[model samples]
Target: MAEASLLAASIAVLVGTVAILVNRVRTPAWVRDAQLTLNASAVTSLLLLVCGALLVALVLAFGIFLLATRHGVVGRAMVCLAATGIAHLGVTVRRH
Candidate 1:
C-alpha cells in the first residue's frame, strides 16, 4: 500500500511536470491568478509563484513523511492534493 501510494503521488506530480515542460514559452499564469489575468506585476507574479511553489513543496514533503511513516491513505491524499496544486501552478486558469 505504501509503495502504491508513492507510485500514485509520483504519477500525479509527473503529470503536472509534463504539463509544465510541454510549454515552450511560459506558463503565463503564476500561482496568484490562475485565470491568466497577469494583473500582478512581474516581481509580484514571480513572488506569488515562488510562494505557492514553496507551499506545495512543503505539502509534498509532508506527504512524503506520511508515506515514510506508513500512513498510506493520508499520504496518498496529501500527495494528490499537492500534485493538483502543482498542475494548476503550471497549466494556467486553475487553482489547487
Candidate 2:
C-alpha cells in the first residue's frame, strides 16, 4: 500500500513537472489570480501552484472516469480522493 501510494504521488509530481516545463514556467492567466504582485519568486510560486492544482484535478477526474467505466480499484480511487484533498489544503494555506 505504501509503495502504491508513493507510485501515485511520484507520477503526479512528474506530470506536474512536465507541465511546468511545457509552460516554460511562465505565470499565465490560464488560472485567475487576484494577487497583483509580479515579482520573480511570486511568479514561480504561482506556476508551481497552478501546475499542482491541475495535476490533482486531472488525477481526481481520471479516477472518477475509471470508476464510472467499471475499471477502477476502490483503493486507487480513494488514493486519488485523498491526494486532491491534501492538495487543496496545501494550496489554500499557501495562497493565503
The candidate maximizing TM-score is 1
lDDT of 2 by residue, 8-74 (tens): 7756864574555445424455223523342337667677667767777776777677668765464
User: lDDT for every model?
Assistant: 0.68, 0.56
Q: Score candidate 1 by TM-score against the native.
A: 0.57
Judging by lDDT against the true structure, name the best candidate.
Answer: 1
lDDT value, residue 94 of candidate 1? 36
Point out where model 1 deviates above 4 Å. 1-36, 92-96
lDDT (Cα, tens digit) per residue for candidate 1, span 8-80: 7777676766666456225444444443455545666667788889988999999999989998777877787
What's the distance in Å from true for residue 53, model 1? Answer: 0.7
The worst-scoring run of ten residues by lDDT in candidate 2 lies at 30-39
